[model samples]
Target chain A: MDELLRPLVPQVLGVLVRRGADLATAEDAVQDALVEAVRRWPDGFPEDPKGWLVTVAWRKLVDAHRSEASRRTREVRVLHDVAQGPVEQRDDTLQLLFWCCHPALTSASAVALTLRAVGGLTTRQIAEAYLVPEATMAQRISRAKRTVSEHGVGADGDLGAVLRVLYLVFNEGYTGEVDLAAEAIRLTRLLARLSPEPEVGGLLALMLLHHARRPARRDADGMLVPLGRQDRSLWGTSLIAEGVDVLQTALAQDRLGEYQAQAAIAALHCDARSADETDWPQVLEWYDELLRINPSPVVALNRAVAVGEVDGARAGLAALASVPDDVPRRAAVAAWLHERAGEPATAAELYAHAASSAANLAERHHLLREAARLAPDAPGT
Target chain B: MAKFLLLKHYRGGPQQRPNARTPMEEWTPAEIAAHLRFMEDMADDLRRRGEWVGGEALAPEGAFVRYDGEGRPPVTDGPFAETKDLIAGWMMIDVESLERAHETAAYLSSAPGPGGRPLEEWIEVRPFLEYTPPVVD
Candidate 1:
């Protein structure tokens, strides 16, 4: 029942807001309607669930307004106005998304709010996912709602912020009860349906491509398996095909963005039968386009790695020189390039250095193993 | 997000060298000030990034206490004279992942030491046992 109703939350709230309901009150009313649904749906499903929710939530909003002495005058006016307005056939989820990702709220608050309002997640559920106290999550949600209300639902909502929030949720991975990545994909799919923006399609493709590789990303013991070392048999072929299809459609539009560029690179990786068979030149080309679009040091580091595969290690090292020194994984990148260039001693030293600097235990362990493998007289070798 | 405690010890940790060492008291005032400032800046940066939960510096003094017996007066001991390990402080953070916690610890370990060099100290990164149950299936 929850799975069926969750997708309708944003649309229902959007309808109420469009009918002159304040965001906070409208959200509360919708939540009440959801609770009522959970109680009543066991007997039978409604033929028009969306309509039922809207009517019930609207009545709840009006009842609360009428009960308040200060809101009595405004209640009659609002009721009359809502009665006169035509039933909105338009999809308001896009507008609700814009409101949820308002610039006034911090990214954390925005993420929390988006999960609550758009994703239809309870505060306890979000709190559990984030490993924070329920009270803290509740406070964050309320504060975000207040901030959005204060901003007054501006016409020009930043799509970038909405995309960013979704991306953030997707990257948060599946630690909590909810599969945030799946939730993110579901939300983005909805957004893509409502908004015909190519970037939305691009983001969806990127997420699908990355998510397809997730099964092969870690070992049974939860240790990370680097892309080159992952068991190819574990990769999701169907997801890869879907992602490629999505990326191709988005690319056909010719309005390229960062996500599309990234998805292109991922698709190239997916196309390869083995690490050695990877189309390094094509991957490097996508990275170049990504740099032109985003120009981040992280992208530059990745480009340097791709350069090592396309050109020689020496060329890759030269490219790495342009990336800032303080960037993470510099030593690991240097080690990989040096090993490929047949400089074993330097590569071993760099691997050790990278191990010390590595933040993730799995990565650190991997680097340490690499260093030990390259040692002059490794034990048991 | 997961919570982690970045523990700083006054002495006796995994990386504490038995012979080659200089205590903070032996450092020059400028070096000490630089190290302190670096720590402060790290906390500030964590706060700005919305990762910081709380942090505090512990005094060098402490005590051990135990119950003498049921319904009896408690027994107390003064701070140990030759304690090998002493907790200096701790910074609690709520970060996106264990990787991020490790990154923050590494950054904090880079605090300046004698001669304006990185201390390269060993910081213990301990995960908080969450009270909330896992939401995942």
Candidate 2:
């Protein structure tokens, strides 16, 4: 029952908002409707759960408005008329997503609000996922809602904010009880269904392609397994196939965005039978396209790594010259390229430096091991 | 955000800075109270900022126990008279960045010491290993 009702949350909230309810009020009404559904659905499931939720939530909104004397100025009659009309089965989730990811809200606030309103996650769950206090997350959600109401719903044409928030959630990696990567993928899949935008498809494919490698990303003791060393058999073939199909379809649309280009690069990696067999030239071309679209230092750093794989280690080091020194993985990439170039001592020192500054424990451990392996007096040596 | 354990050592860590190694017992009572107060206030501030997960100061004395092989009872050893390294306390925090964790550790390291001066103790900032699988990307 919960699974059936989860996807309807955004739709119900969207209907209420379209019927003149404020964003906060609509969300509240939808939450109330959800609670009511939970209490009543055990006996039987409704044939039209989405419609039932929309109607019930709309009534709840009207009732709340009628009871609030201060808000009596709002035309309850117009709201009722709008609610009584034929229920348009239009996808309101996309509009609700746009509202939740409104530019007025900070990225953190946007992520929290989207998780709550669109992803059907509780405030406490979201807080736990973020490792912050429940009250802090609650305040953040309310503040985001207030900001969205003040700014009005953002234009639906741009899904950049929504995609960025989803990407952030995906990158948050697993920590708390919530599987945020899976949640992001789920939300992206839903967004792809609602919006035919090539970028939406691109984002979905990117997540799928990344997620396909989850099984081989960690070793038995929970240590990071770099892409080159991961067990190829553990990769999810079905997800890879689906991702490749999605990326191909999005590419056919002729609208190349950063996400599409990134997915294309990911698809190329996924298609490789082994690290040695990976088509670095094609991968580098995709990175070139990505850099052209979004000239971020992180992308530049990644491009340098790809360049190293395609060209000689010297060419890769030359590529690194274009990237800023302060990028998080700059030293680590340099270490890798230096090692490839037969400069083990320099590689070891850089690896040690990178390990000290690594934010993630697993990554830090991996870098330290790399340093140890490269050191002159290492045990095996 | 990431969770980090800022460990304050009783006896082990980087070499103490020159002119900064005064023992706690030798400090004035007022200075000791001020140091304790600073530690408490730091915890309070972290809680207020919603960054603190937990904190604890361990007793100076502790015993080491090991299980006996087979069906035998466990063997217990006395708290050693001296040890090279002893953990004093730890504060766990969930923060936005590694830099923020370092900043918090630095702040905690500034607890008042002998003559009401900053201790400047080295606080080891270690990230908690997340049990969850990493995202492949």
Candidate 3:
């Protein structure tokens, strides 16, 4: 099914772009057409599946226009142009991508909308991905659609906004039910074809490298295991090699975006034979480049860890203190850095607090384990 | 047609628990308005289908039946307790089928509030059953 739908994306998107429609609407119409074809085409497949989808979706939009009184006249005016166009020549997906990730929408909403329309995800899938209820996701998408209709002027302006939206989606840690990491990679690969930016390639490489080790990141019961504790035998060497290969090519492009820098960090980590051999200095340098570009406190907090590994635990503790209190993972990082700096009592106290404050059970357990290891005589034991 | 009572449990007078902290507000003003709009739309849809009995949004959490101790008759109160987890309001509806009731629930939950967030709190839907018993031999 994936193979069959793969080739139809460009053709379906081409027609949608030409229809002068929003990506959300175009995607809805296309999905409606796809459902119809799935129901009817069991005897034999159509030779030109893309052509059929374009025709069906075009008709569906007309029907939709006729049903809604406000859009009737506007749609009627465009009917002639839609009829005259050859669907194959148009690049609908690319246009839809830009429209869905329009700068007017918030970054979160843009990623949500793009995942729905371009990534072919249902509201349930998106809601699961974000740990929101399905109803909430549905409402979010509906409000976004209304906003686009009432406020947005259409997708004639910026593509960088769209690229940033995709990258953000990639960075969000997996939760709920959907694997956003995989979905983001797929969208980046698709977007790379439309606009082959080095950052796009870099984002893809970064995702691939991280995802390659996903197997070893957690235990059978879903507890997080740090890189030093992870079983290296479980890592997918092929994915690591592929990610390295992609990052190398992207680095050669000389664009040097934040994503490329992040990918470079991942590549260096993947290159090390063991945890001790991992180049903390190189990772710290790349993180500095990332900070120069993005200037995020989260990035600063991460860089502090590298600095600690390279410079010493006391320096890392000071760096961690410089980060804001509310930033995610602040306490855990602080606890670990404090532990390394010969302050076991302070480390255990912070670790216990961090464990209690953890959002998920796995993280709580991991934090508690570190706390217990640091203080054998602690009461919780 | 079947009728549904979206029952909100409002205890009359102030809450007895002194240590209860102030309830965290669920939705802001914008969220409440959006939810009202959704309820209005749902009622309108039901009315159009000839299945809507009549629904009313109650006054804030203060209005409810007050129970008297020692088997005395219950009285009503205007401004209610300081309970944080109080039900703000409810809606009663008359529908033709269980499916329609579910549809109404779905539509009501789809209303948007702050930052495009949905006002998705739990809503209970129960059937109004009518049973006919057989005569004894």
Pick by DockQ: which candidate is best? 2
Please provide, for model 1 over B27-100, each residue's C-alpha lDDT reduced to its tens digit, 9 standing for 90 to 100. 99999898889988987777555566778999999898998988998898979868988888998988768898
What residue runs in model 1 are displaced by over 4 Å at the alpha carbon? A63-87, A359-362, A372-380, B1-81, B84-137
Per-residue C-alpha lDDT of model 2 across residues A183-285, encoded as one tens digit per residue: 9998999988878889989999999999999999988987788999989899999999999999889999998999999999888888899999999999999
- Report the C-alpha lDDT of model 2 over B1-137, residue by residue, as the tens digit: 57899998878888976435887778788988998999899987876555677889998898889988999988989677688788889899877688989999999988878877788898999988654445755
Question: For candidate 3, what's the RMSD?
Answer: 13.2
What DockQ does each listed candidate score?
0.06, 0.21, 0.03
* Candidate 3, A290-380: lDDT as tens digits: 9999999989999899989999998998888779998867888899888888888999999999977764566678788888888968675
- Candidates 1 and 2: which is better by lDDT? 2
Question: Which prediction has more favorable lDDT, 2 or 3?
Answer: 2
Better of 2 and 3 by TM-score: 2
RMSD in order of candidates: 9.4, 5.4, 13.2
Off by over 4 Å in 2: A59-86, A154-157, B1-134
Query: Worst ten-residue run, lDDT, model 2 chain A?
Result: A69-78
Q: Can you list the residue pairs that collide in candidate 2?
A: none
Return the candidate ranking by TM-score, descending. 2, 1, 3
Q: What's the distance in Å from true for residue A182, model 3?
A: 1.3
TM-score versus the correct structure, for each prediction: 0.76, 0.77, 0.70
